[model samples]
Target: MIAKLLSATALACLATISSTASAQSGSGQKAPTANPAQPQSQPNPPSSKPEQQPTSKQPTADRSKLIEEAVTAVRETRNAVRAIDQNKPADAISALERATGKLEIVLARTPDLALAPIDDAVITYDVIGTVQDVERIRAAAKAAFDRGRMQEARRLMDGLASETVLSVTNMPLGTYPAALKEAAALLHQGKPQDAKRVLETALNTFVVTRTIMPLPLARAQSAIEEGRTLMEKSNRTDAESVRLGSLLARARDQLRLGQALGYATEKEMSDLVRAVEDMERRTSGKQQARGMVEPTRPMFDAANKASQPPKSN
Candidate 1:
């Protein structure tokens, strides 16, 4: 009876162990392999998210430095186009594309860069005689596209776009003196209303013309034109005339400041100073100067011509 009990207990314990192993295996968990040469499988590493790299971004002040670099690159590309070897059109196109890339980086960030001054004057690309080169490259690019040279065509297109933008952005400054001269001529002819309109328009617009105007001279010209406009408008009523006198006084003050800064000629300084004083007297309900318009015309002509900077060779 004791032997029979020990056998039954051993059988029950073995059955429980078998049942547990079978359940674990049925649940998709592999039991350890009994073969000595086989190794156990490892579960996949905890599925971690990817690590991102840091970006290299610079400060805002260095943006101007980048603009200068882009300008230099554009200049180089323009120069390269002048001597492009026909057999190696790819080489010239590549250089131009690189320059375009540099420009694009800046343009994307600052579209108003056209209005930004590089060195006291608007940043000028001044691509000397590049229009013909651009046309030639465009023709080549079209031909390449026709021949299924897609890469070359794409490069040429990029270069053309960049060159076109640079050329457009290099617009010359307005001839403020010329406009002032026109205003003076009108005033001399007793057309003060027309003269005033001209002066006001010039002050309000980016008047692009074929004249080289220095920045300081341009500012001085605006002040003088404004003063002259105010003086002309003063002829209506006593209140209006008094207002004009006060404004002209301030305008004369600005001209004096410009003169001290060497922006105006000595002759201009004297003439405008005298004109403002005469305007003050006339507008103050006192004796008006005789032949005011005719006397001031020559002074304006001299000042206008003096304000014009010599054209670049």
Candidate 2:
């Protein structure tokens, strides 16, 4: 048999978001480093075409961490790939057997599973700035996207959002087990070339999904809380009132940023902004601002809550 080279491209580590710091420099704030992959929403990875980039990219450190709790089938798949790379057919067959055995255990528990989850990690990216900054970046990103400059578009929009993104990878239960079994049989038939191709196909059948939590909305809520704390104080000093005004402005700014980033509907953000600015106007004269930020809380709360975490099958 002719020695065939197996093509297995493991996911490359997500590129670090270096430009966000420069983007946020105007606000003197660093975008959340909690490790978000991209500021944009992404679809699940396609089981048929694994060559395309995933909607969510994991930071290198987080990828290393996810490997710590590796699922048995996934790890075995990696082992099988490695064995193929080293031209060790026997080892590859052994790894596939172990993988199938694990799947048997899993399928026995959940027979109707569609896609079995392998692992997930949270990736966060935050771009902290006032409304003007968001507008500037949004325009640039739109132009870049229109020009079909995806990398440029992604970079420009990266700092326009403040979000916590969760990326998950799963194996398609419908076909993966069969592929493993077929690869094993191919090996037994003394066709390592064919077996290697089957294994590669199996690896690419994994799908990925991303869930996003808006950090800007949360920041707005935080600002409102801080302002409310001051309002709760009796005999508030003029300086405190001025500080309250600043906080209200920050809250309004965050709301506007959130709106630009499409975290909330225009109407929803508009209503909140109108209310916040109205309160802000009252606080302008250094007078005690009277209002409960609690009413405004529900909208932000609802938006954040809507971004449910990824569920493993």
Candidate 3:
């Protein structure tokens, strides 16, 4: 069976970009280098203080091992398909039996698992543009789409986001075992063609999911965290205050960007802005705004989590 892969670039083109005009009043033009196809930065842990160009970490070792353990079954399944193509019914059934047995071994160890993760990919749409730019592109795309200019619409939408996409592929446990049994039954009934179809269909039954994370929100979160660290520095000076203000200001800008890009509502963003302002006031002349940022953190965390949509292409 051929692998179904969603490379970073492929994911962006296939997935619909979330865009709507919600530019905040007096929003400054802070275009981030004008390229929407840059690689994503790695997300830092909550306690991390340094600047990080967030990288999507590889699937954890446990998941990698799990998928590796399931490969024998996948390979045997492929062998069964090959046997069917070669018209060797006996070989095909033997391959399938071996495949099924291997799958059983894998499942027996992890009975509670539903879908076994097979593969994953990361997509970064690092668009560098202001809110107005997004609005203009979105409007144009919508107009073109309405007029049935699909190509034009797609072109307009090609680089229309500032976010990261995570795609996971999983093998369905509930239906796959049953499917294998059914295919085996069909083969025993002298229906090699039907059994082959079943096998092929089952091979392609892997499920995929995508989670969209707004980079703007992530940036906002990062900015606040960095600012928090700055506040903890000994004897905060005037220069430190200026940097703190800039960090707060950047967080506000990113929040506005997130709202404009449809990751969050205007009301939600406005409330967040006020929250940032409150933090700003607390840190104006103080050497410790550490606790100040903490109060607004949960709100930022909640908003960022809400902005992510569990969608797929």
Candidate 4:
């Protein structure tokens, strides 16, 4: 009876043990999952960090290429000017228009050129004078045509065509500092013409005021007008005549300088010359001439035109 009791107790203990083992196995099959928001723990090697990519260089501008293109355009313009001078108006006009288009493209792309080292003053003056000359040529052409001067009108038109090209001839090179450096080298090499061409290109790169005369010419004109007004308004005397003579002499000097610099147009210079001649007659004679205003009026008109800024087209 004691042996039977011992066997029954052992079976009960075995059954409890088996039930516990089954529960543990079932729980083991259902593994714990990682939270979606949390990062899975990673095993990293000792002293190891993330790898880095190499830095890339930024793209640089090709200023030399830009300057070369500009120089080529200027040479084309110079050639076009020569064509115009040869009296091929139609061909010259077409060439000039093309040259201008090329220059405008260069100018539009390069804003740094304005601050670049160059002769901005002389270049600006040259361009403006050329532009103004072109306008005057157009007017002169019409006037010549009206007065039955066909040859004169044709010549004026051709001149206008040439001026159009000349106005923009050296523009691109003028704006680039490197071009000036190259020009300096050419000068040192004794290629003055080549150096001159380079400088011209640099000067022609930008346009400024087209109507305002160069400072010296403008000042001289003012002096002449002031003297004329004083002569006409005040009492005529030897001292007054001498004063007027001094003023005329000063004006002549200025005009001469302007001519030397190729600033004033032939017609403009002629008008000034006429005024000076009339003033000389007045200053040298006993009394102021009755027809002095006639010659001087044209001179004043020319001066006035030079002083005023060009109207926008």
Per-model TM-score, in order, reads 0.30, 0.61, 0.75, 0.30
List, residue by residue over 1-313, the lDDT tens digit for candidate 4: 0011112222222222221111100000122121101111112111111111111111123333343455555555556445545645454445445545555555566643432111111111212232234445556778989999998777655421101000111232344445545554554565656655765665555533221325435546566766866557445677777777788777676565454334446777666766676677765664554446456555544543443333344
Worst lDDT 10-window in candidate 2 = 17-26
Report, for all candidates in order, the number of backbone clashes: 0, 3, 7, 7
Q: Judged by lDDT, which candidate is best? A: 3
Best by TM-score: 3
lDDT of 2 at 221: 71
Which 10 residues in a row give candidate 1 its minimum summed lDDT?
Answer: 19-28
Writing each residue's lDDT as its tens digit, candidate 2 over 1-313 gives 1111111122223213211110100022534331222333323221111112332234545434333323678789779878978889899999999988888766765565555546555444556554555666777778989999989888766555556554456677788889999999988998888988998988887877654556667667778887887866667788898788788878887777778777756777788789888777765655455566767766654555443342346
Give one digit per residue, the lDDT tens place, for model 3 in 90-208. Answer: 88889889878867865776676676655556555566777777777778888999999999888877766666665556678878877878888888998988998998898898876
Question: Which parts of model 1 have CA positions greater than 4 angstroms off?
Answer: 1-238, 286-298, 308-313
| Residue 231 shift from truth in candidate 4, angstroms | 2.7
On residues 53-116, what C-alpha lDDT tens digit does candidate 1 reach at each position?
1111223345445435444544544433432423333444454456556555655665444431
Task: Give the Cα-based TM-score of candidate 1 against the true structure.
Answer: 0.30
> Could you tell me which 10 consecutive residues in candidate 4 have the lowest summed lDDT?
19-28
What is the TM-score (0 to 1) of candidate 4? 0.30
Ranking by lDDT: 3, 2, 4, 1
Off by over 4 Å in 3: 1-63, 139-154, 232-235, 285-290, 310-313
Q: Give me the overall lDDT of model 3.
A: 0.65
**What clash pairs does model 4 have?**
170-201, 171-204, 171-205, 173-202, 174-201, 174-202, 174-203
